[model samples]
Target: MTTRSDPVPRTVPPGMADGSSGGTVPARRRRRQGGERSMVWLYVSTLVLGIGLWWLASALGDNALAPTPMEVVAAFGEGVRDGWLLDHTLASLGRVLVGFVLGVALAILAGFLMGWYRLGRGLLEPWVQFFRTVPPLALIPLVIVFLGIGESAKVFVIFLAAFLSCVIATFQGVRNVDLTYLNAARVLGAKDGTIFLRVVIPASMPYIFVGMRVALGSAWATLVAAELLAAPTGLGRMMQAAQQFLQTDRIVVGILMIGALGFLMDRLLLVAERRLTSWQEVR
Candidate 1:
């Protein structure tokens, strides 16, 4: 038999044998680094441009109605120095956190039941649909009457907002799981519990996360409106108090603070989704 010289060794590059691919690894790393840097710059540029536009708008409008960015910054600093801002921020944040957690937990349970069981869907969906149509803010008066104008009242309104948004999304998510997957698992001799835990839950997780994000937004929106219910200390209360004296800068600070907090929370949720769902396909 003719001895065949090892073709693989000849064809493979010197560095590729060791997985470096003749320095392509470093080049790819550099490109990735460059892309990350570009993203950072793009984000910074957009933020700066927005601030510039806001500054221009303030300069062109009545200062009383539209305070300058500098004025807003000064107000923010003063609030921080007085420590009242921190208190209000914490109070508002606490209510949102509590309401969001409760809403999401109950929503996931109810949604899973409704999506998986015919009787649960028939019994619960009509109520869910009815309440979802009614805005959470509209229920504030009833909530206050029953729960009193206390923390529970505010949290209840926020809970409604979060629950309605989340339950619907989660319900759809669970319902949308591909039947083929279920059949395949069944054919492979997987039991109902195994299929549910291994297939249904993982498949529905994306939808759950999406619902959570929506619920978080709803919770924040409801928080401001909820805090309007005789709250002694909250960003929403602070804004309302400032509005009486036309303190536009303070109002702007509250708006900015809410936006910042919401953005940060959303980003955190996104990071969690990415880490947990790394195996899922993405566009």
Candidate 2:
């Protein structure tokens, strides 16, 4: 009778009283917030440390080639105030954007064809591989000869660089798509076009995004050489001019601008990738 006097009612935590996950959800949210904070601090610390080291190097070198960070900043401000910096930046940005868009469009088309069809692969892959083996810089001379060192030549070189970098990746992406998904789609009565649209496209998006990022980097890397095509107003041209005059600060400014712009563009692409591929699991 005493043993059967029954166990006392167990107390439940407030959030778990009704078997709800309210407490655990908040804990997970806090962990995420904490992780984000840590990431932000890490970025800030790295930036500060880099600047400190750069300043120290400049102080130690005390040479024209090793201009101080403040000197570079001054050069940047002067360029901005004189209006040339904005113009050159815009010129470079415009060329890259136009060339990148066209290159990506053509690459996607060519990659899809080559990846999906044996005939297309046999016909196009050899040429793609050959061109890939050829350095973009080497093609600059030919580009100038054919396109006449005009804006067209610059854009063409940039486009070629982007296209070559992206096309291979795109082709691989399509080829690498899981066959199980394709078979599933087929079993579900999905037609070729429907499967391509719904299954293949979504499945291949991560690879396409990777290709796009690679293409973007290629485009930027090719910019300086592209602008070497008798360019008058661009960051690359500015750097070349600064180099001839030994304007190290100005050269550094140009370098920083290119890096900043490239970083920003890449970040934009990353954001787009995360948004579009949210359903894909990531670590």
Candidate 3:
């Protein structure tokens, strides 16, 4: 048997045919590496410039008020060797951890309820608004009176910071959930709990993450302020002591360490968020 046959040739786009677009993946990856290197160089250059300025000033005026960069670095080394820096660092971070977890847990629970249930919002939002507007420092006197200048006071202040920020975030995240998906879930006869757990919670995670990050910054700042007023030991306590002694090198070292540690903590949160939401589509 014989059959008629027709043949057609198809052409693929030029760059795509070679499994590479205008820029091959390897080339783009190289460009990305170059950019990262440039950024690293820029950061290093700025740090060097700052150190140079400080060094030049110290050499010329023989100033005692401001320590040179090298002096601060040396002080940091000494503090580490003496266990003073490490102990204080751990204490401060521990306070933040306990406080932050308590606050975040409460906020997440309350925020979800408030966002989902109208009655909960009506009941709690007024108080939330009132506290949100008030400065954490202003409440120090009251907190001291109630809880004293102990671990409780420090943790209490940090918890308040984390709570207010997280609640706001949770409320907004719930409100911002896609209405269409919610409706579809409802149409499918999904229970309120199921819809919330499956759809709304997942949808609002990005915003929740954003809020958590902001709250962490607030937690650190608030804890430092609380400790500055009165703490047996911590970074803030050490910093206050340094100020009294006019140990400019130790002060500078403490400040730099705080900033570095805070930076690291934020990066850790970011890593957790990325791992938790690996299945999520980027918005």
Candidate 4:
């Protein structure tokens, strides 16, 4: 009796064995790393270009309305030496932190309730929409009058700004959760609470984070305006005082500081987003 010879096993080439070699996986990783490094260089280049242009314009114009980068740097140093910068920055940071925390907490709670329950939506959505249309800055005068020109007034203005932006974002996020996920959970005999906690919250986190980022920007803008109008001490107040005397360098310093702080806060939130939403594909 003749038996069929066993077929010889096919051999995969090195690197191609797991499909990781043929310049596929490693190439992609290299490309990603290269892209990140390029982005950093681009950021630095743009910043340098911007500063160079500013310096050129200031030198050519020789105007009191604009100051050179060096002048602004000197002004910043002076402020630091006198402790003015530290005091104002700290005060502003404290107000922002307090207002942001309170506003985000309340907004998340309210948004979740409104998104989850039809009755809550019916009761809250119209009011929220109406108030959101009215700019947060418009409420500053009313807040100042009611709360007086104190820290409370400034914090309240920031809180309103953050709350309005965040609540809307979070509400939309919850409403946008995929129906498929909910149905699948129900099919698996999950209760409403379990489905919401396990599926809905995770699904909605991206939206919530987007809201938080927006709220931070709003809070900063509102804080500056509020401080400009009534605060005794803060970055806004510093800038306002500088403007009155045509202290252009100081004004530039304050503006730059505000922008730098806002940028830092946004970066922190982005880190948090990446950590919390690691399950979601980044790109």
Candidate 5:
């Protein structure tokens, strides 16, 4: 039997020769580590400064305006143990989620129709523009009158907030689809529906995701305001109640919780965006 010739070994790149190689000094790894360390120190400094200021402020007599961090932490613990915080947080989250889903879904459908059909766009664009100009909170009274001061009214406010932001984004995304790509697909005998699903939507996905991020923020804001106004339960209600009793600690706790939750939601959305748009973004 004849022996086959072995393939040549691939040459190692220039950065691998020295003991101090790219693996040991990776730019990306260094940057990430540096960033994490910086963030940690920044947060620690902020906490220290905040605590010191609060201590000084309390000594000067104004706990109402600047309660200590420890007080806030204790209140948070109390609220958690007593189910005050969790109940409200969960209720607010539920409304936000339902409204956000409905709004985004409707926005996507409306965006597709507006983008693909000129007659539809002409008919609906004016109405959309008018509604978009009107703030969701501005519709609070009208919604309360129409839907009552129930869950539906609160959710409707959040829905409108999310819908307006997302619809504009989706419409822009669809319109931003490359004409050449659509033409190529059409030449290949692709129907409008096929082109929309395969080409237009994929191209618009990045923008839609951007819209989702914005809509989530808008939804959160609207939910809080709506809940503060009329809801029987929610973080906003907790804060409002705290204000009524002048419980600065509870108010602080609510504010902190909202901030933390918003931060987490934003991070989650960013992760989703990165995963979904990996093809378009650099690895």
Candidate 6:
């Protein structure tokens, strides 16, 4: 009676008792967050390092050919103040958007047909290859003659650049679709149209996006060349004029702006690609 009943021992759950499994999830999350933060710092560091190198080079050279970063910044600000920068940027952006949309749309349609039907591919592949081998810039003279040295000519060149890249990409994507998936869809009693829409498209989207990214770069390059050759107002035109006057700072500004815009667009496409292909594991 005085000793009382022996106290009952407590038993913890397996994972909880060890505190291993229970702590794992939080640890993993922390690691993921740290990785993301490190990536952000890396990007920032890269930009800073590049600019520092550029500045150092300019300072050491002390020449007009290699204008300092501050000089370029001043020129950029001056262009902004003069309203020319905004105008030229808008003009270039408009052409790129229009050309890109038209080219991508047409390429998708053509690519689907060529990929799905043997006869279509036989007939179209030759022409596609021919045009693909021909640089879009090479067609500028012919386009200018036909469409004149106006927006039409410039847009046509950009369109051709985007179209060729996208068509090739879409075609390859379709061809690369897994036969196992297609067979599985057939087993599931999926019709041709349904399989194409659901199975084929989703599976091939990564390739399509790859093509689109390439096309975007091509379009920008073509646009710049077109503008330099004939545009009354655009980044290319601005840079060309600056070159004539030996305004190295302005030339640098234009180069930076073009690079920045292209980089931003590419990033946007990459984000879209990730969202759309979320079901698939990407490296």
TM-score (all chains, Cα) for each model: 0.88, 0.89, 0.83, 0.89, 0.82, 0.88
Off by over 4 Å in 6: 1-34
Candidate 5 residue lDDT tens string, 226-256: 8966678898998898889888888888788
- Considering lDDT, which of the candidate structures 3 and 4 is the better prediction for this target? 4
Query: Candidate 6: lDDT over CA atoms?
Result: 0.88
Measured by lDDT, the strongest candidate is 1
| Candidate no. 6 TM-score | 0.88
The lDDT for every candidate, in the order shown, is: 0.92, 0.90, 0.86, 0.89, 0.85, 0.88
- Candidate 4 runs further than 4 Å off: 1-31
Name the weakest run of 10 consecutive residues (lDDT summed) in model 1: 6-15
lDDT of 4 by residue, 1-283 (tens): 9886998787776657556767576666688789989988999999999998988888889566777788888999999999999999988888998898899989998899899999999999999999999998888778877998888888888998999989988998899999999999999999999988999999999999999999999889887887965778899999899889999888888889889999999999998998899788654
Candidate 2 clash figure, as a count: 0
Query: Each model's number of backbone clashes?
Result: 0, 0, 0, 0, 0, 0
**Deviation from native of the Cα of residue 20 in model 3, angstroms:** 14
Candidate 3, residues 87-181, lDDT tens digits: the string is 88899989989998999989988888889999999998899999999988899999999998789989999999999989999999998898999
Identify the runs in model 3 with alpha carbons over 4 angstroms from their true place.
Answer: 1-62, 279-283
Among residues 3 or more apart in sequence or in different chains, the pairs in candidate 4 whose N, CA or C atoms overlap within 3 Å are none
lDDT, residue 181, model 3 = 91
Whichever of 1 and 4 has more lDDT, that candidate is 1
lDDT of 2: 0.90
lDDT of 5: 0.85
Q: Give RMSD to native, each candidate.
A: 4.2, 6.4, 4.6, 4.5, 4.4, 6.8
